[model samples]
Target: MIRPATREEYPHLVDIWLRASRQAHPFIDEACWRARADDMALRRLPACEVQVLEAGRRVIGFYAMHDDHLEALFVDPEVQSFGHGSGLMAHAMTGHSSITLWVYSRNVRAVSFYRRLGFSIVDEREDPETGEPESLMAWSR
Candidate 1:
């Protein structure tokens, strides 16, 4: 089931984000994601609109948004390919003219996932955080 996450569930979202990011971008050092998990738990999750998918009270995936920008979408690496990602995308598309997100260009798993959901790259740039090439993608209603 999918629903707005409770304050207590935010930590689970962070775990999902960290695990999925590591799984999707194995080229990036695992330590990087581990380093970011604290910020995600303490700052980002509280500041964004977060939704989670649960299976009998266990959080398996989540997506975060700021206005029409998709800040993050992640599923537990152990439970991927079971429609959680697509379910999150469909939920995000409602009541918006468009949604935009940035993904590392080399993270082909993420890029392909977004493309399959109708997002197309509209711009390309180097991510200031990691100095890595990235793409800005958008999906218009």
Candidate 2:
């Protein structure tokens, strides 16, 4: 079930991020790690703006939205093919005209998932701060 994320859920969110990053980029230095929540507190949106997908007592996925852009959407790798990401994306689009998101150019699975959701590759640019080329993708309502 999807619901607003509580303060108590923050730790779990951080854990999921760290675990996913380890598998996604095993050699990265811990000091260089950055996840969506790094700036979430400064987004100025209500805390409830982000939704958490809870399967019983565990949080399997979550997504944060601001305006027409989806700031973050991640599912635990252990359950990647089970449609949690798609479900979150669909929910984010329900009341917005379009949503923009960035995906790593090398994450083929995620790139394909966004493409299957009708998000087109809009552009690509290097993140000035991180020096990583991010694929900017967007989808219209």
Whose lDDT is greatest here? 1
Per-residue CA lDDT of candidate 2, range 55-99, in tens?
A: 978899888777777767878889877888888777778867888
Q: Cα-based RMSD of the predictions, in order?
A: 1.1, 2.7
Q: Which stretches of candidate 1 lie over 4 Å from their true place?
A: none
TM, every model: 0.94, 0.83
Residue-by-residue lDDT tens digits, candidate 1, 37-88: 9889888888889988888878898888989898898989998988888988
Model 2 alpha-carbon drift over 4 Å, by segment: 26-30, 34-48
Report the number of backbone clashes for model 1.
0
Instruction: Locate the minimum summed-lDDT window of 10 residues in model 2.
Output: 39-48
Clashing residue pairs found in predicted model 1 = none
Which 10 consecutive residues of model 1 have the lowest summed lDDT? 10-19
The lDDT values for all models are 0.87, 0.75
